[model samples]
Target: MSETDRPRPRRRRPFRKAVGLAVLLAVIGYFLVQRASNSGPAYCTASATGAGTAGAGTVQTYEMTHEQAANAATIAAVGISKGLPDRAVTIALATAMQESALRNLDHGDRDSLGLFQQRPSQGWGTPQQIMDPVYSAGIFYDRLAEIKGYTRLPLTVAAQKVQLSGFPQAYAKHEPDAAVLTAAFGENGIPASLACSGPAPAAGDPEKVRAELARAFGKEAREALGAGRAGAAAGRSKPAGTVSEAEVGLRLKEGGGPAEARRGRAMAHWAVARSKELGIVRVSYDGSSWVAGRDGGAWRGKGGEGGRKGGAGDPHDAAPGEVRIFVARATAH
Candidate 1:
């Protein structure tokens, strides 16, 4: 062929470089978005003193989104209501992280669904029921309880029995974070260990908050949140569902000693975990308080240090072993 007519070598290098640059930028953008989604919007943390668990004077903390924290608190509360102990909460949480990253998903492998990916074909529950985090967590605990000495079993082994995941070892990797979250939600968890901060939504649902509390914590919650409110209302009691938008009080049984105290605190943490959803602006338990949009949502001790104005419903308003939840008003702009 004539030199001029000969086919010129294809210019591949420039094409390859352009493609490489696009791929690199795409990867970088993906990671930046993931980081923002994880750390932005709202966040919650569970911190434990390492004096015995890790090391003296060292603090170990696990941070997760407000959604993860709320789901975790529900798991812990349901387990506690069932008298299932903290180990059960840890196992349930690790399994959820492995299966759905602690999100109550509507779809999963085969008929699997919800937090633990329980399948309806395996008799876990209907999709609608399993989609309820409380229901899914309860079902998981029921199955876990049937296993002999499940509390003593290795975390992965116990979770595998419930999940039967293809990758049994995947559950192990989440155990550390799960355990930290469990410690924050359990009765013996560090005081004020669980707190959440998210954008102040325009409004919140007090009835939904009451309903969720009752469902997660069982009849005890009903009595504390319902009967207590009724008694306080005197002759002007309204229907149970008519909780005020601006406030919800959880008067845990007047007294049961230290365990009762911790239970109240755990409930308080639950309120904080769900602050963004329930429109909980402030939560006070024992003496410490947590206020969303303030102090990075950290819990504060008495004396208004948490940024609450001295007024009718201050954080210190809560009596011993009592928890007060102040919600967002419907009129909030």
Candidate 2:
């Protein structure tokens, strides 16, 4: 009886091992599926078809959207950062990073718009204007900058000053998230290829716009930069209308000089500042366009001014995007 019972007991051991192995394999399979299905929010992973691929040089679709949000965050942060104490950038980034995750959302606690969730009803601006990421961010910074001793103030108080939310303390909860977004979005923090889906400018006919940009950039400016594409339909006309430093940067980044890029950034900021007053619809420089697209919301342009296909005379003025910075300097001068 003892031998029979002992002999029979051995069968359960192998069965138990097999069951354990199956469970282990299943667990590994589950995690593998999860990783393949979705890359975490902090960063998006590339797919087999290379969808949403963002890296230092790549600008994936998600990264681009995130970059747009980051740019909006930077716009707001830089506005508040000027002449303010060190913590101002931190507080501003933190607030925006948390609120809209720097995405300039259309909806919020109640009819809020853009990065800071500024309410049109509160006299911030019109819905269309407030929804403009740069404009909304500018307004937020303007108000925040006006707050005396804001840097010394508690984070909650500083944010409340600009936001005036019903729950003043709520901004504190966002501080951590804001930090993460800030780090992720900061200069080269995320990959250059990190991109998101947004509105693209008019695609059909660029000839008229290019001609305008070429006319605006001036022959001397075009020659100095070695711009190609002398007779393309969308040559240089479009960029001339509103050349932001970004347009300049596109040219420089493509191989424009240091003087060009520096001047370009200064102008882009200046042009963006004057967006409301000028009735200016678009500003392009540095291979990018900040203007109204067929769909809307921070549309960027391509080719045209950033390229060098124009004629020898270089009939464009100010290199298109230099106006914004040039104007600021002019005012100060």
Candidate 3:
């Protein structure tokens, strides 16, 4: 066979090696694109202008995942329902930030679980109960209330009293984030302060809203709504069921006092925080409004009546005592 004859022993091995390398590179590129596409935004930020009422002030902001933000809101709601002040909320938030970074984990160090990293063996709850954020938060507060002036203690000290973390000092570093979350989620912190970014969740179920309200507030919510209706009837006559189909109205007891207003705001914010999960589109109370996927998810003054312009004149405005929630129509899906 001549040097160039005998079919050159074929270039098959080199061609196959090149093909394999190209395939490997293509696979790597595909995975890289997939990772980029699947990864969500690194963080979500929420901000509020005024401290509480319907006025403008320096904007206070906090950044976290939607899950973290939602969990923070739940923790705050649980505290407020118990009449625990913002201080208590701050302490709880700080502890959670240190323990589980505000995530409701199914597993943790040993048997610890949920937001507070509570231990089942340590008597926090069963593994299942500790994994429920609301139940865990309630028990955390129950212990905190026994701390004898927990509100007066330093942030780390108070959180340590509840968490009993070996590294108690670690909580202090989270105090700033915890305070920001408390201010955004607490009743007295601000109205419409917590705003989320990204596409809104599916339309919320009205029945679910009612159930969650009752679950979070218990008898207080039902009693307040009834008292509010009675007061409204006594004050002046209005047509029944005047609210639009898209709206769900919850009236706070007219004479239920400041606590009622506080509860109202707490529920309003709760609905807003869980808006994506619950499919709530708009939440309005005390003349301020928050609409999902609007104004960067921040609260704005109710234009005309509804959060949107030219609606049935703001169901909330007509019944100032109520917290009005607007959900997307099923057909709109």
Candidate 4:
């Protein structure tokens, strides 16, 4: 065949194949990103101010991931266990907000890790210990308590004494947000002020919730709720209208007076704050109730009598004595 007339061998379109492969990979990447974004825990924001009443000051709110909210709850719980006042919690939270943004990070300057960014080399704790939100929070409080006048000191000064950060002033800006969180978490006696908005967490185990409660609030709180009890006396209590030990919840005694009532409210708010993480569905204290995945997800009136004796028909109407926490079953979530 003449050169011009010769049939050219069919060329393989390698470029086309490469383009097809690239497009396929791009589609897969996009879907993976979307799935990851959707499957992770939902973001929640809460706030409280003034008397934590409807007309409270400016009503400042703060936004954070569910993880941050949960950690904030633990911090508040631990501080309360140590008998630290609300001011102490406000300072601790503001410091954490400044140090780690309320996230338990595994990295920071010069071996700093976890919330508050304490350095192991400086006696914060072992890396693993520091990474634990509870331990780290305890350590933070332990040091704060050592400060001669942490409670009366300015927030910045109190936080600076514990954190010793180069940017001491940074903690001040977070004070407002910290205050809101502290109040919502019951540091200032405002139960049900904090509410989370999202799909309820995967069904949570009440046993696991009990263990976590013990870890955060101390063993006495869990024991008081009849956790790990076996005999008739184990879970059974004589409190009027309170849930029995066999029930899948905790009923804190309100008869202990105002101090005890305040403690009950603190625990109740902590449970609500951690509902997303612990699979908690409802928390009732004083005369209010918070239900996850209900009524656009906010605290609402239970509308009955207040106290343990209140009928189930009006869970919110219970009087101000004990707090009740309900965890959703695995299948329920």
All-Cα superposition RMSD per candidate: 8.0, 13.3, 9.7, 10.5
Best of the candidates, lDDT: 1
How does each model score on TM-score? Answer: 0.78, 0.42, 0.74, 0.74
Best by TM-score: 1
- Candidate 1: TM-score? 0.78
lDDT of each: 0.75, 0.44, 0.71, 0.71
lDDT of 4 by residue, 35-106 (tens): 334333355567665632245445667777778888998998898778788888888898999999999998
How far off is residue 62 in model 3, in Å?
A: 0.4
Q: Ten consecutive residues with minimal summed lDDT in candidate 3?
A: 229-238
Q: What ranking emerges by lDDT with the best candidate at the front? A: 1, 4, 3, 2
Residue 94, candidate 1: C-alpha displacement in angstroms: 1.1
Q: Could you tell me which residue pairs clash in candidate 3?
A: 51-189, 51-190, 204-279, 305-313, 305-314, 306-314
Runs in model 1 with CA error above 4 Å?
A: 1-40, 51-53, 189-192, 227-245, 305-316, 331-333
Candidate 1, 1-333: lDDT as tens digits: 789999889999999999999999999988656444333357888876641245545666788887888898888889888877778888888888888887888887888888888888899888899999999999899999999999888998998887777899888888877777776776474432887755544457777788888999998788788644421211233444443346678777765665566567668889989887777777777667776776766777774537555533442357765777777654422
Better of 1 and 2 by TM-score: 1
For each candidate, how many residue pairs have backbone atoms clashing (under 3 Å)?
0, 67, 6, 12
